[model samples]
Target: MVAPARLDLDQRGDTWSSLPDHDVDVLVVGGGVTGAGVALDAVTRGLSVLLVEQRDYASGTSSRSSKLFHGGLRYLEQLNFSLVREALRERELMLTRICPHLVRPVSFLYPLKHRFWERPYVTAGLTLYDSMGGARSVPRHKQLSRTKALRMVPGLRKDALAGALLYYDAKSDDARHTMTVARTAASYGARLLTSAKVERLLREGERVVGAEVTDVESGETATVRCRVVINCTGVWTDDVQELAGGRGQFHVRASKGVHIVVPRDRINSETGLILRTEKSVLFVIPWGMHWIVGTTDTDWDLDKAHPAASRADIDYILEHVNTVLAHPLTHDDIEGVYAGLRPLLKGESESTSQLSREHAVARPQPGLISIAGGKYTTYRVMAADAVDAARPDLASNVPESVTEHIPLVGAEGYHALSNQVETIALRQDLPAWRVEHLLGRYGSLVEELFAMWAEDPSLKDPVPGAEEYLRVELLYAATHEGALHLDDLLARRTRISIETKDRGVTCARPVAELVADALQWDSGRVDDEVKAWEARVAAERESQTEAADQEANAERLAAPDFRNRSVGRALA
Candidate 1:
């Protein structure tokens, strides 16, 4: 097994310095899941690779997703059987072999409104769903009477359903999973850089060669020469294709998806809920101590960096989910709200929900490949397809992708370690639940956290407002997990922003102070970081009250991004 790569400021400097020295076989543009998957696939296939992201890893659509790894059950209703099968296969791989520590089974109850036809109609679809992916990692679907269903989910209104169907899917912390994939690729000799933007593509007589990248923090530029460039930027696909000096084969449309997080006690359900709406389906997903209920689909053309959820978007979710709940939720019950954009391949359908979820791979020109329009569940398949499309430009002996057989860093001995949780907690002088939490997030990588705790026992103490996460986890984020700013730690690494009612403002300064030494931040810099986060939270709160997208977007953009060099304050 390859030794894990430490992704910190020191390694980032080393990678940036070595950029002008050598040419790589493939240069990937984007740092989301697909880009990370492409890097892992390309490097493991014996190609020298470099992956660059304009912001932090999974800071975009990847981090702000439904956080489920399931076959789109609704796709089966659309008769898109092939896409469902492929996603289901990948879901099984993630559950058993690839990242067992990160992905786990989650059950959702599908309520039946009609008394007769709905039961068999849904039963056939679920049976097909259970059989399509070959070997299953989770149990099959089970039918429940209305009384039994109400007992299972006591919060459901008695009149909302005549019966229900319970089926299994999987969920994960998407940001952490994507970062781990990037780290796993780095462990296999791939170079990775965050806060680096690709200014332009290097061209030699219309044949693409490399890219000119700029450091977002230092304002320094470097020319990186490579054989081929894979454009995996999600919503910004068109923008990057313009850098290549041509229009892509297909256009990408950005669809806005918004979610609201509320405390778990507000919802009385052991299993998650799935509801059908006029345009699309809604998921009431169970997120640790909070319930993530949302996703309103609408066209968004305003700000791409931070999509804002307006009053209407939140009301739409509440109206739909409240139809089945015994107690309705209000704005005051919501702890947090977030918005993300989906990169859908533009089609004849006017509705964004009607757009295709299947991905496409196109060689728009020689030495360049553009991949767009896929669901999160099928990222590995999309990466494999994108790399396969580059084979003609690559060497003759370039091997096929071997990522299917390779386990991610934390998956090596995760199951064995999980069995010893009680013993580990006893030996470490910690509670059993804390050990379980660490094991679920880090898997066998918990050993690394143990080493830190051994050095400083105080690191085991919990954060001030976000007690669910230990101080050691925040230190690990700065020292090893490549967190450049306080937002990166509170927002993505630990999920303090959405999990807390104050949106991480109460703990922002304390967290900044805790990670100051590892990130080399001075006292003034610490104050600046905390202020930036507070401003962001304030903007989001103001934006959610607006009625229109234009108003909401302007409100959200009032906060200057600390990572943007134009803001004149570099958090990096």
Candidate 2:
């Protein structure tokens, strides 16, 4: 196995200095899960690869997902059986072989409104769901009587359902998973550059050769030459394709999905809830210490970076979810709200739900391939397809993607280490639950945290305001996990930003202090970082109160991005 490359400031400097000198085999132009996956697939295939992201990794749709890695149960109704089967297979791979530490089984109860044919019909669909693609790790669906269902979820309205169907799905911390994938790719020798935007596609007489990249941090431009470039820019797929000198083979429409996070106690259910809505499905998902209830599938024509969930969106979710809850959730019950855009393949149907989730890979021009419009569950398949599209440009024999067999860095020996969590906690003089928490996030890689703890036992102390995460983990995020800013640490490395009641504001200053030295931020710079994060949180909160897209978007953009100002300040 190749040694993982350090992705800190030192390595970033070294990588940037050396980038122009080498002819990269593949250059991936996005840093979402799909782009990260493509980089991993390409690097493992014995190719020199580089991946670049404009913002922090997974800051886009990848981070804002329902956080499930599931075979979409609703897809069965559409007769998209193959898509369901393929997704199930990927879910199995994630649960068992690849990143078992990150992905785990989560059960959801589907309430049946109709008394008659619903039971048999739903049971048949679930049976196919279980058997398809040889899914074994997750248990099959179980039919429960209305009484049993009510007992399981006391918060659920007794009249809401005649019965219920319980089935297994899987979920992960999507942002963390995406970052791990990027790090795994780096481990296999892929140079990763975040905050780097591709300004233009460099072409030699229309055969695309490379990209002119702008280091968004410093405004430094570098012409990165590559044999083939793969565009995995999700919602920005069309924009990237246009930069490559061609309108893409297929268009991608953006579907906005909004989710509100409420405290776990707000709902009395032991398991998650899935409800059928008029436009699409609604999920009352079980997040740690919180329940993520969401997702309106309306078309989005506004800003892609920060998709704001308006008051109507929140009301829509609450109204639909309240239909089944004994004590209906109010605006005050919501702790956090987030919105993400889905890059759905454009269909003739006006409804976004009717649009296809299946991805397409097309070499719209020589030396360039674009992959877009896939669900998060099927990212590996999309990556493989994108890599396959680049085969024509390669003179050397490109090896097939072996990502299925490759366990992510932390996945190796994760289960065995989990069993010894109590022992480790005893030795480290920490609580067992804290050890378990670290194990779940870092897997076998928790040893790094332990080593840090060994150096300074104070590292075991929890972060101020956000006690769920230890101080040492914040340090690790900066020193090891390539967290470039306060947002990276608060938002992705740890979910303090969205998970907390204050939206990480109270902890922002403490977290900034924790990584200030590592990131070489002066006192003023640290203060600026904290203020920027606070402003961002404030903007998001204000946006949620607005009624329409225009007003909501305007509210969201009210806060200036700290990164942009910081970059300019540094350069000056």
Scored by lDDT, the top model is 1
Best by TM-score: 1
Assess the local accuracy of residue 66 in candidate 1 as a C-alpha lDDT between 0 and 100: 95
Looking at model 1, the pairs that clash are none
Compose the digit string of candidate 1's lDDT tens values, residues 1-572.
Answer: 77888899999999999999989999999999999999999999999999999999999999999999989889999999999899899999999999999999999999999999999999999999998876389899999999999999999999999999999999999999999999999999999999999999988887799999999989999999998999999999999889989778988999999999999999999999999999899999999999999788999888888999999899999999999999999999999998999999999989999887889999888889999999998999999999999998789898988998888888889999889989999999989999988988888889999999899999999999999999999999998888898889988898999999999998898899999999999998888888889889999999999998999999999898979654435433
lDDT of 1: 0.92
Instruction: Provide the lowest-lDDT 10-residue window in model 1.
Output: 563-572
Give candidate 2's TM-score.
0.98
Per-residue accuracy of model 2 over 1-572 as CA lDDT, tens digit each = 44555579887888888888988989999999999999999998998998989988898999999999998988998899999999999999999999899999999999999999999999999999999987999998898999999989999998999999999999999999999999999998999999899999988887899999888878898999998999999999999999987778999999999999999999999999999998779999998899999889989999988888899999999999999999999999888888999999999999988888999889988999999998899999899889988999875588888999998889988999888988888888889988888888999888888888788888889999999999999999998888999989988899887788998999999989988998999988887888788888999999999999889999998777655946325323
